[model samples]
Target: MRRVPESAEAARTLVRTALAAWGQRDLIEDAALVITALVSNAVHHARLESIRVIVTRPSEKCVRLGVVDRSRNIPYLRTDSDGDNTRGRGLLLVDALTDRWGTDRYRWGKQVWGELTCD
Candidate 1:
């Protein structure tokens, strides 16, 4: 998808469709939020014409959602103890919702991903 704010919605749609198709409907809500946050970060920060959105059921019990960009910058949480800062909470929210989340740095770029698994 294009590296634009509107692409976040498009990413959410792709996640929603993929989850339903994979019979992983239970993950759709959190997955959508995860994808949106990831996409928003890439769109806002990455210097590229487009970013890629990935949605895959890596296992029958797990769904993986990711956003790929050409930026090597990794994401970090904003630990605002006072909750006064409005920025940097995206990763915190993603961390709260996903079973596991991290980034894969590559020669070309990086993939920031999160996973949801059935309990």
Candidate 2:
């Protein structure tokens, strides 16, 4: 996907459609939220040429979604709770909603993934 603000909505629509097909629509909201964060990070932070959003059903009990970008930068939760900070809170939302989340590094790029319990 192109690195743009609209990419987040595109990812959410893709996730919603895929989860609906898999009968896991219950995870749509959280999954959409996580993907938004993932795509935003890839676009704003990594500034990559392209980004890939993958939503997979590893099992009937879980749904895993990831965003891959052409950067090796690892994402960390920012603890800056200054009430005025407008950025750096995406991962915190992800952590609260997902069962587990982390990053994967590859030679060419990195993937940040989050899993949701659907069952």
Candidate 3:
């Protein structure tokens, strides 16, 4: 996907549609939130012109969403960010909503993934 500002919303819509089609509509909102956070982080921090969003079902009750970018910088929660700050809350939201999340580094770049439970 293009790493523009709109990519976040586009990823959300893609995750939402995929979840609905897979009969996992219960996970749509949480999945969308996580996907948006991951995509936004890739776009804003990695500064990649293009990114990749991958969604897969690893089990009957869980869905995994991953965002790949061209930078190896791993994301961390900004505990020092001001409560009113808008720019630093993406990873925090991802941590709160996802069942499990982590980052993987590759020679080319990094991929951040989050899992949501449909149950």
Candidate 4:
């Protein structure tokens, strides 16, 4: 996945593989959703040649997903003008689906991340 919109799918695949290996198959759906949103934001906004996707088991029951890109711009949940609007809802979905979400800033870029817990 090379900093393109298609990379989101690749990221999702990685998430699925990692989760299933960790016996967290139930998280595949929500994890995929978050990786897509985070990757899509990077591809559309970062304009870099490469990006990084991370799926980590911070704890036995928690998975943290992160997308790293070389852009100073941080992602925020955009306020929708109306309910009918079809765009800019990605972070909104991330917030609803994840137990917690935030970013890690580095000198080169930022990693926007979300966490999901087995319930």
Candidate 5:
């Protein structure tokens, strides 16, 4: 399923709903945090006109969540160049928390996706 929301709260809510529906309540907090960071990055850095959230279940024990933004710019993993900088740590958190995550580029935009194992 794909949902487009204009605000961060809305995006979080969408993620929460998906988590609930998947019977993965335990993952909601981290999932929501990741969604918020990705969506916020889409809105802020990509200047995306809209964002699409997609939740898919490929197996009984795994759920894949993707945040698609209308930007061709790809996201990268970066080490903090300055210790005092307050940003650029979101993807780092995602990497640490999720079982698997990656980015896919499409013709119109790109999808940043993460997989959560419910088992």
Candidate 6:
């Protein structure tokens, strides 16, 4: 789904709808958090031009969620941060919550994606 939500709530709703189809109610919060953070990062750093959230069921037990932004910059996990730093923890949270995650560059931009397994 491609959306240009002016706020985080709209992004959360998109994630909720995707997860609901898989009957993975328990993963909603984590998924929403991941989506929100990615979208926020795109908005803040990538200029928030356009966002694409793709939800794919690669198999019966695995669902992949991808957030594609207009920027081609790939996200990295920043560990060396000041204790007082308020930003730069989104990907870390995604790493902790999802089964697997990574990024790939596309023709238009780059996609930061995570996979959740309903095992």
Cα lDDT of all candidates, in order? 0.88, 0.89, 0.89, 0.89, 0.77, 0.77
Clashing pairs in 5: none
- Write out the backbone clash pairs for model 3: none
| Residue 95, candidate 2: alpha-carbon lDDT | 91
The reply for model 2, stretches above 4 Å from the true place, is: none
TM accuracy, model 4: 0.92
Flag clash pairs in model 1.
none
Estimate, for each residue in 16-60, the C-alpha lDDT of model 4 and write its tens digit. Answer: 999989888888999999999888888888867999999998897
Clashes of 3: 0
Better of 1 and 4 by lDDT: 4
lDDT tens readout by residue for model 5, 1-119: 22333566787787889889878899898888877777766766665456777777889888777788778888877786768885787788778777889999999888998887885
lDDT of 6 by residue, 26-104 (tens): 8888888877777766766664456776777899888777777778788898878769887888888888888989998
Report residue 98 deviation for candidate 1 (angstroms). Answer: 0.1
| Clash count, one per candidate | 0, 0, 0, 0, 0, 0
lDDT at 80, model 4: 57
Model 2 C-alpha lDDT per residue in residues 1-119, reported as the tens digit of each score: 89888899999999999999998878888889999988888888775678999999898789999999888888998777969776788899889989999999999889999999986
Give stretches of model 5 more than 4 Å off: 1-6
TM of each candidate vs. truth: 0.93, 0.95, 0.93, 0.92, 0.86, 0.85
Quality of model 6 by C-alpha lDDT: 0.77
